[model samples]
Target: MIQNSGIGRVLYETLLYLLDNGDEWILIGNPEFLKQLPGKRNTIVASHAPAFHPREFVGFPRRIINSADVFFTPNYNIPGGIRVPIVASILDLVYFDLPEIVRSPVGRWIRRYFARRAVRLSREIITISEFTRERIEYYLKPGVPIHVCYLGITRELRNQRADFLRGPRPYDFPYILYIGNVKRHKNLHVLLEAYLTARKNDFNCKLVIVGKMEGLRTRDAGIMREFAQLEKQGDIITSGYVPDNELYQLMAHTEVLIQPSLYEGFGLPPLEALYLGRPVVLSDIPIFREVYSDLPVTFFDPLSVRQLSAILENHSWETPTSIDTTLKSRELDYAAAAEKIYSVLKKYAG
Candidate 1:
């Protein structure tokens, strides 16, 4: 949990689960941050480099660790750069999925290098979804076992009331919501194009894009410029980083949540929409089909603006599609996921 990103949130959930289920757990990371999390009695802030990279391969400061058996990192690499037996969770191989986003030859090579190193050193690999596991197998061919675990819905969702109209709204009229950051691989331009095309058919819905607006790494300037133009026209509204309570309520009331991402370890928006009983229009990707097989979600070709437009035109406030309430995600499977992790750690823990 080096920073406040999706991966950090996932790591926080892993920490919470371990605290409740496992005994004698240890957390190793940045002191000022990881120490802020509960269970301080078990935390150890070993001084590592400014960032978590293979610079650790240069040298791992191990004088701090007293004794440890299995190194369990909720993320790809363990803190202090332990190149030994461990259970490491790799979120995505998106660099391989969308190579154009990699930007640098050396950066891609280093990522591949670190991924192979992480896989080779680990006793087992944990992926967020079966899609990610297959992706890793396709690229790395690491002989270690791969485990798939799904994330649970946020606790804030449970506190959701039917008072959405009472809360502050990002837009006055009906809107389709898109959560998460704007990144190159997200294929946001496709959404904008589709939204514009659908508006011609009187779709009558503003597209609300929500996430942290400032201090973001812009991977594609072209898409950012397009977004700015759309925002100016009021075709799209950007509600930079709404709080969880408001976000979930917004999801509950939105016309439909759209995820046009080209690649994802596990798309949480649709899953969160699953809890909110909101229909999702997702990119026709294998991972969504694999994860939300039971959930009835509209699929669209991510590259084809026509297909997305058609899906949007069909979904409108006047003729709203019935969201299947039974279409819930396997979020409750966290206990089983934790158990599987615990079993693996217990086997290797000496």
Candidate 2:
């Protein structure tokens, strides 16, 4: 099990669930992140490979195949030359389908190369949503069994306790939340512009962006400066790399969770907010629509600040919607997701 990503957090929860239910597993990744895993029985093979970069996994195939029964790459990019049943989770084909949105040329090539290999070498494939399933079918060899096992929010986050004494509550007004790394595909500039417009029109609320600054290659730094200017004017709160507890607290108290990602395989934040009983304003993308079709979420165009502003200005907070608890109980639970993954593993292993 190679783990390193936002999705890796979901994988760790799933592995723990599997262990709790009497299935054993090993972890392969940076020792720092894997140290947070629950059980002590599992072995941790320290790997220096950076999660997103494929070059880091250059000679990893033999090492990976030698250790595990079935090799699973949770995010994407399977190590080459492996002699085992490689079970890969292809999160999204966004790199192949939307190359323009990708930050770097190397990132795009790495994704393109490994995605094809994942289809060829894997005995079974997994994806986060049905929308991605179709994309995989179109791009990869036909008839590969691609399972849609949705990612879940951790239970600890659901029952999180907010800190009353935490430093003046971060922002002045209760704000809509946007959580994730600030990447080009995240559409942060558009979100900032929309929030500014909404605030000007007596929306009277702030927008809180919680994530690390990324995408330096695509000149996202200029956009970050613009957001900083907005912050100076008191319309936004830019919390860079917050602790997990604080993130949960922020989600718990947020007026709404808005994710304007241009593309996604399966967005965990909106589902997480839904699980926390917070109102969600998401992009009108197909993946989000498929995952949250039945749920009552406000949708906006990720590319259009005006459309996003309209949704923000016109939202009603009084609707009694339990999307958060419902998703937590029905979809985002680790035990349930682990059961599905374990079942698939058993079927293939047999």
Best by TM-score, which number? 2
Q: Pick the candidate with the highest lDDT.
A: 2
Q: How many clashing pairs per prediction, in order?
A: 1, 2
Q: Where in model 2 is the C-alpha error above 4 Å?
A: 1-5, 52-55, 61-64, 161-172, 214-226, 317-320, 328-330, 348-350
Worst 10 residues of 1 by lDDT: 316-325
Query: Model 1 TM-score?
Result: 0.84
Q: Tens digits of per-residue lDDT for model 1 on 1-350?
A: 55556887677656656656436656656777666555534756554553445555445454443356777766654545464467788989987778777678888776777688788778998888888989999998999899887776654454453454346664578989988775777877788778877887988888888886554444557656766787898878888876677687788778889899888888887877756667788887888888765666777789998988988887632232333343333543455566667778888766
Poorest lDDT segment (10 consecutive residues) of candidate 2: 159-168
Each candidate's TM vs. the true structure? 0.84, 0.86
Clashes of 2: 2
Candidate 2 to truth, TM: 0.86
lDDT (C-alpha) at residue 88 in model 1:
85
| Cα lDDT over the full model 1 | 0.71
* CA-lDDT, candidates in order: 0.71, 0.72
Candidate 1 residue-pair clash tally: 1
Clashing residue pairs found in predicted model 2:
274-324, 275-324
lDDT string for model 2 (213-323, tens) is: 654233456656766787798677778777666777687678888888888888887876765567888888898888876787877777888888887787743343666
